[model samples]
Target: MTDQLPDAIVAGPKGPALDLLHIVQINEEIKSVVAVAFKINIMALNAIFLAKRAGTAALGFGVLSNELRSFSSQLRETMLSLNALIHASVDGVSAMLQDSRYNDILERAVVLASKNKHLQEVIEQRENATDQFRSKLSGLRRALRSSVDDAYRLVELGGVLAKSAKIEAAYGAGFSSSLSQVSGEFDGIVEEIRTSLDTLRKSSFFRG
Candidate 1:
């Protein structure tokens, strides 16, 4: 992902590392993924029931369905964590912006009261606050990247499981067609989640 912020968010030494609106958009996207994951879990349970109805011929398919259900749960959990990280980052950015404004006002005050030692001390304190916020934002960015990577890996594993399910479906005898349809649904849902993640990774916050 590019380190460049989009035109909508101001980028500079004084501006925030990320904007609130952008963070809100990211949260909405993650929510969509969570919704999709929920659907996947339900579909997996249905597939498991169908496999059981098919008897021993669909044993492998049943196992894969169970695995898919577990995977969906994992994906949802990862997304919730990501959402929390984003919220924390937003809080940090807001604090930094407030500190920056205070610093700017203090610097102007220093110009008027150049001989005031107390005002200079306050300015120094504000500067320290800004630095602390920057450090926090940096740590949060790293965490967001790590979480995104974990999510990407999980989605990849889901894709593998979906393909395996499709293969196993072929051994379902009379239930092969039904099993195949469920596998296709799984693949499609996984692809949708992957697409959303790709978009999120391309956002400015994921930048180095």
Candidate 2:
């Protein structure tokens, strides 16, 4: 059960820190994008379903739904760019993973010591990089690294939709699209989550 999810996965050993500081950051960014793209696609697909039920009345709000769809397209484009980053990270780590000299230097750090948000932000980025490689350095390895970064970016986009939902409620404006969008996105999050976790489990790390 635990092996089926990459979210809580923490790497154990079998490697040194691949000298990939810059590429690692790029990989996280890509992960954020893939996550976001999955989310947006689900949202748009849900919106389509909702609009169909709303009938002609929903047509009046077509412009709004269209705008939301535009956001989804942009998110996909961003994910594509992140795909390139994933390739680079994979290339850097492939050679290092097979070497025995690289001991277990790829685990999580202790606690984050930061009073300021900026410093804390820096620490969080560093933590995610280590966690990303620790858990996913093999198998999909770097290919999925970009996908993980996309997940965070997806959450960020959700933050926008959540706020928009609040606005939709304030004036009694019936943008049911907001509700359906979120519902669909939630479904997507669950699915990809399972997919990623299952993938990580099949890696050489857990070989019996």
Estimate the TM-score of every prediction: 0.85, 0.39
- Give Cα distance to truth, residue 124, candidate 1, Å: 1.7
Q: In model 1, how many backbone clashes occur?
A: 0
Reference-based lDDT, each prediction? 0.88, 0.49
Error of 1 at 18 (Å): 4.0
lDDT of 1 by residue, 25-134 (tens): 67888899999999999999999999999999999999999999999999999999998998998898778768777787888898999999999888888778778888
Candidate 2 stretches with Cα past 4 Å from truth are 1-36, 45-61, 97-158, 165-208
Provide the global lDDT of candidate 1 against the true structure: 0.88
Query: When superposed on Cα atoms, how far off is each prediction in RMSD?
Result: 5.8, 15.3
Position 100, candidate 1: lDDT = 73
Native-to-model Cα distance after best TM-score fit, residue 27 in candidate 1, in Å: 1.3
Q: Clash pairs of candidate 1? A: none
Residue 52 in model 2: lDDT: 55
